[model samples]
Target: MTTSRTVPSVSVTYARNGGSTKSNELGMRVMQERAYEKRGEQYLLIKSPPASGKSRALMFIALDKLANQGLKQAIIVVPEKSIGSSFADEPLSKFGFWTDWTVTPKWNLCNAPGEEGGKVNAVETFLNSDDKVLVCTHATFRFAVDKFGVEAFDNRLIAVDEFHHVSANPNNKLGQHLGEFIARDKVHVVAMTGSYFRGDAEAVLAPHDESRFDTVTYTYYEQLNGYEYLKTLDIGYFFYSGSYADDILSVLDADEKTIVHIPNVNSRESTKDKHREVEHIIDALGEWQGTDPTTGFQLVKTPEGRILKIADLVDDEASKRDKVSAALKDPAQKNNRDHVDIIVALGMAKEGFDWIWCEHALTVGYRASLTEIIQIIGRATRDAKGKTRARFTNLIAEPDASEEAVTEAVNDTLKAIAASLLMEQVLAPRFNFTPKTPQSGPVDGFDYGEGGYDPEKSNVGFNEESGQFQIEIKGLAEPKSKEADRICREDLNEVIAAFVQDKQALERGLFDGEHAGGETLPEELTQVRMGKIVKDKFPELDDEDQEAVRQHAVAALNLTQKAKEIAVTGPDVEKGNTALIDGVRRYAMDVRELDIDLIDRINPFGEAYAILAKTMSEESLKQVAAIISGKRVNLTPDEARELARRAVRFKQERGRLPSVTSPDPWEKRMAEGIAFLARMKAEAENA
Candidate 1:
């Protein structure tokens, strides 16, 4: 039967990073938007799924509140150093006057000489400085007061991120200090949590005494205010818990979630024969099964499963490292996307990681602490679509674990995040958590390109505050047209082509932005010469991205190249290696002689030049899958690869080939089936 070809759409709606409706006017969503809408409340406590855009939501609301007529300043607190700039780098920042107001350990109102009076100085500066300030922490709120004295920060609004840390260890000196400082006021507070917040909020918030503000929380199953952030990962749930794999397939027949039920394998050759079975399984799945939409990567189903320990999985140091490397060859096993769905080891999925459209989570490892568990679960707990959307986080508890215990663990850990945001609601709205004190000497830290990224290569810290977007995005791409026409039109397609061209230009630059889950980062090429502005705004015909440049240079070659392999001929044909070499040579010649008339004709195997590229290598798949009820394109990468192999066999056959399930037999069966159906239809139609 003849099959349909892929129909290309002339226009497409590009996904927006900051979710907006008008396609241009950026606004708040889910939890943060809900919190902002309820501005009259003295305390705004939000329990949102992490990476569900809680940080962005809270930052936007804080900025909005701080910008209101009567507000003075705000404060924010967080655990990670990377989180400090989530608000600082936003283009829609409404806090122009407050840029210098927030106070943090690395950044504060006054400078500390030789680190002397570092904490006390930070507090004193915030208290004494006329500009309203946000007080944040690497150190606890208590430490800030101890260094500067309690009088310095009396009624300031406070925000705590990863809020449970405050109560995680209350007996510490700094904990007591913050506990005491916050006791003086119960106004303007926000504590944010991605996990469900439980436990004694009073002991954590007003540790010095029993003080509690009214609490407010939004979870994934309930609302949409923050749900938009999680739309990509909605299908993430199926594979993680290893539940409903078959159900998912049956329900969404045309659109199925290819579950590479990949178990871990050993990749090391030095390993004993004991673990070979699993090693074979994993090695088989690691090869290029398909190429993705990006066109460069051969998309493979990444094996992501927890391997049981033995004299193998976790035996010796050398073996362990080898085993780890082998197992992680699968993208899903790396706790990364590209693979459909997975439930993996926590050791792999750390912070600052996200997967596009993947927001379901299943935590199985019992050894991890509550904090690590929260981070793991929240990795996929993005905000949802529809009403204040939030992911439906599921905890597959081991029989030994108690519901109360798990809830308590979640509460105790996430409270710090909840506390910091609540503190911001009461004290500083926009980045009120203590802001970073500016570095005095030659500032030295990791340099993240514009927008708070720790640039892959770093020996120096950087601030885009004083730079232009053109300069700030030194290595990142920019839109050539600054085009904002209809979302779907021929003009949009034209601009998208320009968008791809602009992307190629950025790829040639020293700093290059590589796609990650929710964000992008520049790969550092070198530091000898820092890139200034694109001196030539529309730089001259840049050939640095020569491969990306379309040209007629390759038109006159007289050879053609196609994908080659070690063809396993019948037992009679002993010239395997020679035949492979000849096939490759002749294929190259075939590609060289290809007609130059058509520009859009993609050599079915790939570009003729791709045969020699490092990334184009292929072998039998690591995991081979076949589509059941639909087309091959309807199948996954692995399925399509199998179909391609079948088609390749058909192409190579010049004589008799094996006829296990011959076309005539299948056709006869179809004819008989049709005859029976036709008789029934004739009777029914006649009746």
Candidate 2:
């Protein structure tokens, strides 16, 4: 196999303080304790990373709600039956809690052997009975709500796990049911998810409905930093020319425990023969021995004499695949490092499939949504004893100039980049931005680095324990309403998700630069495009609130990119744990000032493009740019209006309208916007 030429787009090293794994008096970890503290809230949303004790967190809160809060019953809804295993009987009392969590065998409809339609009856029976908890899939819950109506499940707790499955779209039954439940307002609802945003860019909840829930957010930085092991997590993508299996071994290290998710049959990367592909992967590994009789795991001896126990979940044979699946999920071998080495799957092992020993999650194609990508990354992030580092690699097919589906290939490339960008934001430390003012000072717990809270300029402060950055940016807009403030504080990443996923913004940002003759200006994306996205997304927010959200979202995204660029290229790159924090401070110092305009002036995807250039072949990169540039259209009336607004703001601040001859690219672009509008007006009047 040829050696792979791929660099990690985002490599984050943690302090490994062991704080997250430590249990409190009630046997709750840090995140669980945090979630349990808000157990009394009628509407609670838990936004925590995978394996940060989200399962136990729900148990702790559900128990409290039942015993102390007068809730009659708890219905735990999960995305799939496999995840239902997470809510299985937990002996909390053995771990020093007041009570143990137990679900009646029959009431646990997920384990019931039947279609979801049949399980709705079990849900109805359980609701009528005195059982404290009933665990079922989201489907069963939806069907039950449909048959019995929302009022039948009153005075109970509805805990939706993997809550990102619900969407605010009217077509999404779960979201519609949730809205009805909230409108009824008799039941307490607790929603939990590692990714709150949908891959399809649908809102998880309506604004008015979302505002009612008290949010408990636990950052990925805090979870990974406090781990006892697993000091580093690397996320990257690789571009391959031919079939993916031939290039699989280039990035797949046999010794590390890994999950290889082959491309779907319809995906461009797939060779269309999954079984043969699996056989090919097995053959490439080494001489394959017979399947293990007891476990059904295919045993192979590498040339180095190491035996690799591989689980093949892609097989179409149900009995054989079931045995392999059962072997992987066997509780007796959960912590045994040698239980399984590699899991090759097509549609399994993604959401809630746990194998703590996984050191690499290699996916063959771009997943359908960012939520899936986050879930796949979570597979490799679980802290294990010997797993000091874990990485997630997306092996994608490079766009070929000879292919008829080159446009589709380019779209996949853009989507992959978008996923990478969002994951960086998700994994990095949270940012708390305030407008730089004379009254600004360092917060109580934050350390302002060497200079220690310089009031004369915008400063960057970091609170290591909380894994949050305190930033002051000049001319930053602050949200006026409580809902808007909550969004700015807690939902900036969600905003960034929508922004990066915007096709127009992403297309222009990635390909419209020097390769496409440099006609696209940064302000068009940062201001007009992003401005339109924010307005359409949160129509409830007024102009100032929208601008505030826009500024905060853009600043957070751009600063993270800037910090990553500094951290990776800095002189002290070896100190990866502190590189990001130091990079943020160093950037602020280098620029001499931090402001919204300066942040917006920088292309959010510039560094991404630089990384893309390094990874993809020069020829393939040019093909993608050519395909995107060919589709570029002239400015729309809406775009002109947005830029004209920015021009108005520019004139107010600089005492003159932007001139076409201005040396500044942004000023010249604003002038072009004015000219476009004027030309349109003249033509309309003449017509």
Q: Which residue pairs in model 2 clash with each other? A: none
RMSD of 2: 1.3
TM-score of model number 2: 0.98
In the range 435-528, model 2's lDDT, one tens digit per residue, is 9988888899999999798989899999988999999999999999998899998999889999999999999998896534557878788899
RMSD of each: 26.2, 1.3
lDDT of each candidate versus the true structure:
0.32, 0.91
Q: Write the residue-wise lDDT of candidate 1 on 1-687 in tens digits.
A: 111111110001112233321121244444455565666555565655555556665555565556662444566666654345443434442532232223343443122234434554565566666655453453645556566576554445566666655552466564565555555553356666654322232224431232233344443323322133432222111111122221222222111211121122321111233234323433344443542332122233444532222112222346454444344344443343333333233234334344433333332212223344345545544432331211222221111122334333222212222222221111100100011122212233322323343222211122222110111111212222211111111011111122212312222120111211111111111100011111121133242212111211111111111212212222312442123223322332334322222211222112211211221112101010011111112123332333333333334653443243545432222233334444657899999
Deviation of model 2 at 452, angstroms: 1.4
